[model samples]
Target: MASGLLIEEGEKMRTEEEMFQMILEIAKQDERIRAVYLNGSRTNPNVKKDEYQDFDIVYVVNDVIPFLNNPEWLKKFGEIAVMQEPNSKAFGWGGDHNEQESYTWLMLFSDGNRIDLHLDIKKVALDRYLEDTLTIKLLDKDDFLPDLAKANDQFHWIQKPSQIEFHGVCNEFWWCLNNVAKGLNRHQIPYVLKMYYEIVHPQLFQLVDWSVAQKNNFQITTGLFGKYYEMLLTKERYEAYLKTYPNPNPEAIWQAIFNACYLFRELGIEIAESLGFSYNLVEDQNMQRYLTQMYKKENDK
Candidate 1:
């Protein structure tokens, strides 16, 4: 029984207040539930509010045994369109908590609403609570949740890199670029693209974002792999990043490789400058140009 109802065109979707009220009402009836907390985007002020935001709720229960043993306890909320227990062996967690026993259930309702509910029996510690992005104490019977400051942007702070970490990131980015070159030479389009996406892109974007954060005091997300690079980068520089993508023609593979080299060199230089380290952009450019010409000549034969 699955149904998708598109809300009236331009009608306001259900609010967080409405969802929270419903969760609270359920908690009030269940005495075993000691406390309730919320996490994820709903707690992050920086994140824009929209219908897509999920209600990530947690219930601190007295004993998780009854709930964990019987699957039917979840029906009290609403008709579950589908449910996933990440902690269950079927999915992954295997009902084992090394430190303290806690169970998590992830649910999606029929009305396009979702909740990540966790039931923990242990006492809520303040230090551990603050480690995650954002959390709010919704209800407390014994009043275990700490009296902490409201959620802030500190959770996503840009950590300063050690000398070793800096070198490691540079080494990884350069080494992975070799795989992209190899894949292109062998005419393996998927392999080349995968290597670029998995290794080169993340390092390049992370470096750029880290530099921006250092300059501006680490306030923004940089939007998931420089997806919003236009907002953060100059038109010229953003255009350069865009040009890094390789054209599909086997004959044009060398051009693509050259593009990757150009983009990576630029990113590396940017990273080094931000960290006050020296970089050899000229050396990279020479090597890249030589390789591209060699590949082009070989393919032309």
Candidate 2:
């Protein structure tokens, strides 16, 4: 007879119910584990449910050191395909790399289940639990978890931009393009792509989100990195947004930059006009001219 604690090998992907049961059973067996709760997409009502979503579980423990010292207990879930202990000294995540106030283990089982599990002392968990509204209590062995409101993504809502914020985004978009231009002109593909995606593109996307918010009354969630962009943007606007992504080649890269500039201009002006905010047309024109000269230079080479 197989022990209930050991998840059988070659088993099909466990259903949510099975996963939850196993999680609770593990907590129940370990007297050190005080309570268990869930966080992230599993707790987000607005997020579409999918098999790919991993369990983001947190266990409030009497003490974290025992769990940290003896991690072999996690094997009860299944054979670990891979795992990461972010708080471990090998990871050097942040701080002194040895701090153990709270610890996290992200694991993927051979049965195709992933769990990002955190162990925190009861005090540490209780003090910071309310900070993320996307949370749900799974088990409370001693009634340690407080009554929480229905889990929501309200904390992730897009906010209305102040005038200063508007100006700052615009300034960042235009100013950073110079770095992209210089990289492109020097035929430094890596530098150009890095600047385009990492530095410049985020500013453009922020403007795009703001424009969407302007139409939608600034009360929406674009779902982290604007994942909802395709759904939120109009067909024409979304198509334009796609053009901002460029291939590694010089011509394609340059064209993508032009495409980005065009989209930013149209959206930026529309937003400024609607909000009665100043749009620095002269600064925009000068940057456009600089981009054209750089493109011409790249072509001449």
Candidate 3:
């Protein structure tokens, strides 16, 4: 909990039951909201309990326009500190949701509770019910939402990578380092950081995911973008991963870049050996030389 949040003195966080009751009570009051269900970490049995887990709720309504028109209805939940309606055209992101079947409001209350509420028409919600394995039907006034299998994180598990995917990951990781080298040599911080984080980092993380999955028999979930990397990876490895993050200092950025390359190469070879896949040593060696030259050139000046 951040000290900056406007929580009243002696105010206590609501329990899970209280939160659920408030959610269900809200739906029960609004005749427009017919059914309610839960998604995300709240519904995943594998996820450990935490204070920050969100209530990913969906209310199956006949029409979403009425709710969209009257935004004040959200006040009934609690004293909201911040909120975002990502599906609303006026204040949204990613897509044009003018004709979309569902609308979402991501709310953060004063007491630190968050709810990612969704308003979906009955037909549209039902059509996609079976798609997500982590779903729990919370309330159904008319029994519209079907009974689902026990929620699991199987859908979120790190899958075993194919030979082609392995090759692609390795190729992309090494190939992108050249761009990082060029950007670093030119003293272009934005371009270098973008290439390092967005382009190179993803390929490295993909290899990490594959290695973790292979070691664990492809039966583990890393909890959304390696959020559980600390818990899943060895302490030394995790510490090394922490070192891969760099500040704007050129020396620190160069060190972070090298850390990422070494981590990627280490994990890449481990995965390749385990799966009997051919690892491209030549690409790795060539990229290492290229980055080293760039590093020396920049520091020598």
TM-score for each of the candidates:
0.80, 0.91, 0.94
Q: Kindly provide the TM-score of model 2 when superposed on the true structure, using C-alpha atoms.
A: 0.91
Over the stretch 72-146, how does candidate 3's per-residue lDDT look in tens digits?
898888888778877656654637565347888898888779999888898889887878899999889998677
Clashing pairs in 1: none
Model 2: worst 10 consecutive residues (lDDT sum): 1-10
> What does candidate 1's lDDT look like per residue over 65-96, in tens digits?
88877767787766566777776776565756
TM-score of 3: 0.94
lDDT of 2 by residue, 160-207 (tens): 898999999999999999999998878789988988899999999999
Give the residue spans of candidate 1 off by over 4 A. Answer: 1-13, 92-100, 124-127, 223-260, 294-298
**Model 1 CA RMSD to the hidden true structure, in angstroms:** 3.8
lDDT of each: 0.69, 0.86, 0.86
Whichever of 1 and 2 has more TM-score, that candidate is 2
Ranking by TM-score: 3, 2, 1
